[model samples]
Structures are given as C-alpha cells and as structure tokens.
Target: MRRYTVSTAVTLCAVASLAAAMGPASAFPAAAPPAAHAVQQQPAPPVLVDCLWKPQVHPGDFMLACGDGNSRLASLRWSHWGADSAQATGTNLVNDCDPYCAAGTFHSYTVTVRLDDPKPWAKNPKMQQFTRMSLVYTDGRPDGFRQTMTYPLWS
Candidate 1:
C-alpha cells in the first residue's frame, strides 16, 4: 500500500506537469494557448472526497479514493457515471484515509471547519441550512459506498 501510494504520487506530479505543459492546444483551437491562465497541477499524495450531492442525497452512497496530501479539496477532479460507475484521479488524494490490512476493517476520517465570511453559494434560502459545512472529495468514484453522517453548524 505504501509503495502504491508513493508510485501514484509520483505519477500524478508527472501527469500534472504534462497537463500544464500541454497548455490549451486542445481547449481553444482558434486562439493560441492562453499564457495568462496557468495550467493547474494535480497535487502530490492528494486525498480527495466526492461531493455528496446529486443522487447521493437520494441514493445515499459514501465511498472515496485516497490520493496523497498535496491535492486541494476543490482541485481533485471527479465524475459520476451513475449506478456504481464512477472514476476519479488526482495526486495526494487522501481527504480521509488510514492504514488497514485486515478483512472488514473500518476507517474513520473527519474534517472540522469554521465559518468565515458569508458567501452567496449559501445565501439561497434552500442552501442556508448548509452554510458552514461542505462535503468535498479526493477522487470522486463513489458507487458501492454509503453515507455515514453530516454534522451540524452554528451561525
């Protein structure tokens, strides 16, 4: 597992560098690659979590992929293909991770957040209930997992 993690971390850094180097050759065919917008790199040992939105609210699934530690919560890329078909890849993707080697071993991960300046994303009356807390991800493949819990936040 340690070797896997190390290998994945190195690969991600290399891929991130490649992606950055590739530039906007494919994104914008008409315009030359924009130099103003820097290419975003995949973080090293980046652990990530999938956003518990969309069908998860209805289907209730909670599974995540562990990257490393250098990836950002918002930068870890993801995709939901529906009905247990999902895939995510990033660096240092270990939002909530642990070491395990036995059968049926359960691991717990937690993130604590504090309220800062108010943001419009939570201003909507329907979203006000979710103000200070957020559920983000590492690699966003969550098909067989299940939802555990969401905490309370005080304004």
Candidate 2:
C-alpha cells in the first residue's frame, strides 16, 4: 500500500463525512402537480339585501338584513350616489345582551355604508346588481369590535 500524506487523508475523510451527512439522492423526489381534489374552488358569497323592502329598495332609506333578525340598518343618509358607487352615513341596530341575544334589547351604532358598481352575477351574466357593500363604524363599537363589514351584493 502507498503511504498517503496527512493532508490527503484529512481531505478524503471530510468528503466522506459530507456524503454521509447528505444521505441518498433518492430521498428527494421531483416536484409534481397538486391533486385536483386538493385544489377545490371556493363558492361565491351569498347576495345581501335590504329585507325591509318588498324587493324594491327606496332611495336614501334602506336596511341591511343581518339574517339572524338580531341586527339591521336602522337609518341611512346618502351623501352621494354616482354611477359606480354610493356613499352614505347610517346606523346599525344590533342586539344588546340584556338576557342573552335572543331576548336582548337593540342598540344603534353610527356607520358608513358604501355601495359599489353593479356587476353581472356569476350564475347569470345578464342580470346586473350592486357588487359590494362596505360598512365602517364611525362611533366606537360597544362590543370593542373594530372591523368593517364588506358584503357581496346580489339581486
């Protein structure tokens, strides 16, 4: 056997150690497309409406139905109504927990309601409706909530 230099033996040992640490190349596989079921599409948001109307919304007076009947738009004062959008100040009447929500009293909160431009519904492109409504509370919420309400509009 030929005598190896100390430097040469150290370098070989280092290389072997590195290779062992890296493990086998087969441990890593090539990237593949995600499964079809794993990439499901989200359903469209439900359309909101002023439940107080008879399917006909009056100018300057509209109430947003909270679905639970525990909350609604108590009053609205439109500042402007353009072709694309409308801005208004309003009051959201929400239930106050007196004896729990179902039997609770209602209270009003100052809010700003913004209505976006009409858009064709996904189900029917021919029918146009307000696409979105955004509500911002000007007065501090009694419940300490600080988020705005942005809703999708339908017919």
Candidate 3:
C-alpha cells in the first residue's frame, strides 16, 4: 500500500510539471490589421487666424495650444483681468522633459499665468499677440518650469 501511494504521487507530480511547461491555450483569436481602404484618414489642419477675445467668467478655464506639440496649457482660470494684464492660474502640461518627452511620462505643474495686453505681431501687421506670460507655481512644480514665457500666441 505504501509503495502504491508513493508511485501515484510521483506520477501526478510529473503530469503537473508537463502541463505547466506547455502553457495555457489561448481563449481569443489573434488580432488582424485593418484593410488599407478601411483605415481612417487624418483630419484637416487647424486654421491660422488672429487670436480673438473669448469671454470667460471669473474662475473660468481655458486651454492654450502651443504650435510646437511639446507644450500646452492644460487648463487656465482667470481671477482678474484689466486693460493691461490678466491675473490667472492654470496647469502647464509639458512633454519636453529629460529622457525624451514623447512616449515618456508627461509632467504637470500648478501655475499662475499672467496674460498681458495684445501687442502687434511684427511678422503680420494685422495680427495681435499676447505680449507676455508669467507662470508662477502655487505648488508641485516640475524642474523644467520656467517662471515666465513670452511669445506670439500660437493658440
């Protein structure tokens, strides 16, 4: 009886090991690529125009799309605005960090963005620009946060 039990236990262990090495069977079919004609096409490019004033109530949010795909204002809210400048706050989402930005993790910082008066764009006489932007962090600033950014309004 003792010999029979030992042999049965050894046989069961060998069968279990073989099954583990073989691995489990797939439950689903493999994925197939879409046909050339069936694949969706890219959309049209964004229209370039003068930046017009879009009304927003106090503490309203907005996004700034920088032409260069690396950086963007994820969201912004104005606390106050006057003829010369506007006091606002927002998150700057950037993809230009170390170790390469694309496919890497995007970092976000809580910031205060000061939007100054529209200045004439030298390249285009008819276009106006956001003369300056000052970004201040309330907290959680990434190492790359520049306190201020000046520019031609890409958004």
Candidate 4:
C-alpha cells in the first residue's frame, strides 16, 4: 500500500488559520501584549491528538479501543479560558493492545482520529483546547514508525 506522510507545519498552520479565520474572530481572544524581555512567547501548543470516538464511552471500552490501535491509556490535558491547564499524561494509551488484532493488516501505516472533546468545544486562543500526540510502531525492521494526529483548538 502507498504511504502517507504527516502534514507539515506550514500546511497545518495554513489550514488551521484559514479555517479559524473564516469563522468568528471573537472565538479566540487576542493574546495580551507581550512584555518587554518576557522570554519569547511560547509558540501555541502543538496540535496534539490522542483519540476521538463517540460522544461517550466507558473507561474500559476506551482502554480497549486504545489497545486496538497499539496504544495504551494516557491522560489528556486541557483547560478553558481563565482555567489552569492540566494534563492526562503517562497512561497506557495503546501499549496494551496485542498488536495482532483481527482487523485488516496494513503494510505501510495509518492514523485514525477519534475526537471526544465536549460538544461545541470552544476553540479558544486564551487556553489550550486541543492536545497533540502520536503513535509509534515498528516498520518491520529496526527502524520505527511515527504517525501524528493534530486536532484544532476550540474555546
């Protein structure tokens, strides 16, 4: 099967910016003016991807799905405007999957995204609305495989 490469930052930024630009600017609040000598502004958090699924899911079911993709449970960190940021890291996301699931086998690679964010999740600029993440596996050799999933941030 043909292989697909992860989108570049330029492309992703353009797409994200374009999509957001078309919508309402009132969504993401303007960044407070930076202070002089304030260590360079940390670039907006990378658009990470953990999983996207149906509206609701049982904890056990979520773990099972992650395993199917060769991932394990992992914490998800997100915060709304005026709220402190938090992380759902260090969980067994897909590591528990047997990797030999009965699903169709692929020679190259693939990434399936499952967004579980709250309904009408705000794409706010004042806070992180989406998380960036990826998955790794073998390429049938010593070298490994990498796939990234980037979701847009909402207020």
Q: What is the lDDT of residue 18 in candidate 3?
A: 91
What lDDT does the true structure give each of the candidates? 0.34, 0.67, 0.59, 0.37
lDDT (Cα, tens digit) per residue for candidate 1, span 6-95: 999999999999989888676756755667558765322211123433221211223332232222322223443222223333322233
> What value does the lDDT take at residue 136 in candidate 1?
28
User: Where is model 3 more than 4 Å wrong at Cα?
Assistant: 1-67, 96-98, 121-128, 146-155
lDDT winner among the candidates? 2
RMSD of 3: 19.3
What is the C-alpha local distance difference test score of candidate 4?
0.37
Q: Regarding lDDT, does 2 or 4 come out ahead?
A: 2
Per-residue error for 14 in candidate 1, Å, reads 0.8
- Distance from true location, Cα of 43 in model 2, Å: 30
What ranking of all candidate models by lDDT puts the best one first?
A: 2, 3, 4, 1
Cα lDDT tens digits, model 2, 41-117, are 75432222445423333244555554677767756777765546677787888787678988889888898888886
Task: For each candidate, give its TM-score against the true structure.
Answer: 0.17, 0.53, 0.47, 0.23
Model 2 reaches what TM-score against the true structure?
0.53
RMSD of model 2 against the true structure: 16.6
Better of 1 and 2 by TM-score: 2
